[model samples]
Target: MIKVGVVGGTGYTGVELLRLLALHPGVQLEAVTSRGEAGTPVADLFPNLRGHVDLDFSEPDPERLAACELVFFATPNGIAMKMTESLLNAGVKVIDLAADFRLKDPALWEAWYGMPHACPGLLEEAVYGLPEVNRKSIADARLVANPGCYPTAVQLGFMPLLEYEGIDLSCLIADCKSGVSGAGRKAAVGTLLAETSESFKAYGVPGHRHLPEIRQGLETVSGQQVGLTFVPHLTPMIRGIHATLYLQLDDPDLDLQSLFEARYRDEPFVDVLPAGSHPETRSVKGANHCRLAVHRAPASNVVVVLSVIDNLVKGAAGQALQNMNIMFGLDEAAGLRGIALLP
Candidate 1:
C-alpha cells in the first residue's frame, strides 16, 4: 500500500481528498493535518466521512509528513512551498494541489501570487499533473503540480483543437462559470447563500490568476503563445465548472467531432459526448470526469466546445489521486471510479 499524508484537511479540496483516499484500496491513510483543527477527529468535522475515516486531524509536522512515501498538500498556495523542500529531501514525493509550483517562471509566479517562490529551482523539475498531457513525465516525477480547476476544464476543452494547425491561436475565449464551493470552504460574504443564490455575475475579468497557467499549458501544446480572454463567473450551485470555449477555425472542413473523439478515446476520465450534445455540469458532479462536446454555428467558421467537471473532484482531489496512481504505477482509475452524483 502507498502510505500517504494530506496537509490542510479542513477545506473543500482537503476533505474531498480524504473522502477519496479513505476508499482508495492502494492507499493507506497515514495523516491528515489542520493546524486549527488538530486533535479533532476528521469524521467529526465531516460527517460524510464518519464511518470510513477514523483518523484525527493533526498539525503539519515536516518529519511526520516526510515519513510517508507521498504527501499531498491540499493547503493554500503559500503553505506547500515552505515545506516541500524538506519533505522532498527526506525522500517523499510531493503533490501540491495549489498554485505554488504550477508556474515555471518565478517572477511570473511572484507577480500573480504576490510572493517569492520558496523553491524556484524545483519549478523546472515539478511536472504539471495533467495526465492527459503529462502522463509520462508525472510517472517519473518526484514532485507534481496539479492544475487548477478552471485551467483543467478550459485546457481539456481546447486541447484537441490546439493540437492541429487549423484553428486561429489568437483570439481564444474561455467563458467559464463555477459553483460557490470553488471558492474553497470559507466564510466569505460573496459566497453566502443569500448573496450567490438567485444571482449570476463575473469576477476577475481584468485578469484571473488561472489565466497565465491556462495560457502556459495551451502554448506548450500549440507551440506558440495564444491570445486568450478568460472570464470566470460564480454560479449558485455547490460543485462543478462549466467552460464555454470559443475558437475561430481557419479550416472549416476540420472534422471536430472526430478530432475530439479520437483525442480522448483512450482517456479514462475525459468523455467526449456525441455530436450536437451539450454536456451538463451535474453530469460530472462528485466524479473525476471532464465531459465535452463540440459544436459549430450554421455555415460559420467559429467552433464552440462545452466542457464540464466537478470543481472539487476532477478539478482538485480526484485529479490528485489520479496523479498518485500514475506516480505509484497503479491503475489510473483504481480509486477514481465513482460515478457522478445525480439528483
Candidate 2:
C-alpha cells in the first residue's frame, strides 16, 4: 500500500485530499500536519470525515514526513520548497498543491508570490502535473506541482485550439469564473459571507497571477510564445469554476467541434459537449471532471469554448490525488471515480 502524508491538513485542498484518499483502496493515510490543530482528532475538526478517517492533526515535522512513501504538500506557496529536498533525498515522492514548484522561472515566481523560491534547483525536476499534457512526466516524477485552479480550467479550455498550428495564437482571450474557495482557507474579509454573498464582480482584470501560469501551459502545448488576455471573476458560490474562452482561428476551415472531440477522446475526465451545449458548473460540482463545450461563429473567425470543473476537485486536491495515483503506476482514475453532484 502507498503510505501518504499530508502537510497543512486543515485547509481546503488538504481536507479534500483526505476526503478522497480515505476511500482509496491502495492508500494508507499516515500523517496529517497542522500546527494550529495539533493534537486534535482530524475527524473531530472536520466532522464530515467522522468514521472515514480517525487520524489526528500533528505538527509538520519534516523528518516524520520523509519516512512516508509519498507526501502531499497542500500548504501555502512557500512551504513545499523548503522541505522538498529532504523528502526527495529520502526517496519519498511529493505532490505539491501549492504554487512553489509550478513555474519554471524563479524570478517570475518571486514577482507574484512575493518570495524567492527556496529550492530553485528543483524547479527543473518538478513536473507540471496536468494529466492531459504531462502524463508521462508525472508518471516518472518525484515531485509534481499541481496546477492552479484558474490555470487548469483555462489551459484545458484553450489547449485544443492552441495546439492547432492552423489557429491564431495572437487573439486568445479567457474569461474565467471561480468560487471563493480558490482564495484559500484564510479568513479574508472579501471572501466573507457578508461581502461575497449576492455580489458578483471581476477582481483581476488586466493582470492576475494565474495569467503567467496559463501562458506557460499554453506555450508547452503550442510550442510557441502566446499572448493572451485572461480575466478572472469571483463567483458567490463555493465549489466550482466555469471558463469561457474566446479565440480567433487562423484557419477558418478547421472544425472546432471535431478538433476537441478528437483531441480529448482518450482523456477520462474531460467531456466534450455537443455544439450549442452550455455546461453548468453545478453539473460538475464535487467531482474531478472538466465538462467542456465548443462553438464557432458562422459569420466570424471566433470560437467560444465553455469549460467547467469543481475548483476543489479537478482544480486542486482531487487533481493532486490523480497525479499521485499516476505517479505510483496505479489506475489513473482510482479513488477519483466520483460522479458529479447535481441538484
Candidate 3:
C-alpha cells in the first residue's frame, strides 16, 4: 500500500483529499497535519470522515512526513515550499496543491504570491500536475505542482481550440464562476453566506493570480503567447466551477464538436457532452470530472465552450489523488470513482 501523509488537513481541499484517500484501495493513511489543530482527532474536526479515517491531526513535522512514501501539501502556498525540499531529499514524492511549485519562473511566482519562493532551484524540475497534459511527466516526477481550480477548468475548456491553428489565440476569453469553497475553508467577510447569497458579481477583473498560470498552460499547447481576458466570479454555491470560454475561430466551417470530442477521447476525466448541450456545475460536483460542450452560430467566427467541474475535486484534491495514482502506477480512477453529489 502507498503510505500517504497530508499536511494542513483542516481546509476544504485537505478534507476532500482525506475523504478520497480513505476510500483508495491502494493507499494507507499515515499522517494528517494541522499546526493549529494538532492533537485533535481528524473525525472530530470533519465528521464526514469519522468512521473512515482514524488518525489524529498531528503537528507538521518534517521527519515524520519524510517517512511517508508520498506527502501531499494541501496547505497555503508558502507553507509547502518551506518543507518540500526536506521531504524530496528523503525520497518522498511531493505533490503541492497550492501555487508554490506551479509557476516555473521564481520572479513571476513571487510577484503574484507576495513571497520569495523557498526552493526556486527545484522550479524547473517540478512537473505541472494536469494529468490530461502532463501524465507521462507526472509518472516520473519526484515533485508535482497541481494546477489551480480556475486554471483546471479554463485550460481544459480552451485546450481543444488552442491546439488547432484555425482558432485565434490572440483573443481568448475565459469568463469563469466558482462556488464559495474556492475561497478555501476560511472565515472571510466576502464569502459569508449573507454576503455571497442572493448576489452575483464579478471580481479580479484587473488580473487574477490564476491568469498567468492559465496563460502559461495554453501558451505551451499553442506554442505561442495568447491574449487572454480571464475574469472570475463568486457564485452563491458551495462547490464547482463553471467556465464559459470564448474563442475567435478563423475557419467558420470547422467541426468544433468533433474536435473537442476527439481531443479528449482518451481522457477519462474530461467529458465532452453531446452537441448543443450545456453542462452544469452541479453535474460534476464532488467528482473528478470536467464536462464540456462546444457551440457556434451559423456563419459566425466565434465559438463558445462551456466547462464545469467541482472546484475542490477535479480542481484540487481529487486531481491530487489522480496524480498520486499516476506517480505510483495505480489505476488513475482507483480512488476517484465517486459520482457527483446531486440535490
| lDDT top scorer | 1
lDDT tens digits by residue: candidate 1, 1-343: 9999999999999999999999999899999999999999999999999999999999998888988999999999899999999999999999999999999999999999999999999999999999999999999999999999999999999999999998899899999999999998999899999999999999999999999999999999999989999999999999999999999999877899999999999999999999999999999999999999999978899999999999999999999999999999999998899999987
lDDT of 3 by residue, 34-150 (tens): 989999999999999989999999998888888999999999889999989989999999999999999999999999989999999999999999999999999999999999999
* Candidate 3 Cα lDDT to native: 0.94
- Return model 1's CA RMSD, one decimal: 0.6
Model 1, C-alpha of 60: deviation from truth (Å): 1.0
The deviation in Å at residue 148 for candidate 2 is: 0.6
Q: What is the lDDT of residue 122 in candidate 2?
A: 98
The global C-alpha lDDT for each of the candidates, from Candidate 1 onward, is: 0.96, 0.91, 0.94
Model 2 pairs in collision: none
Q: Which residue pairs in candidate 1 collide?
A: none
Model 1, stretches more than 4 Å misplaced?
none
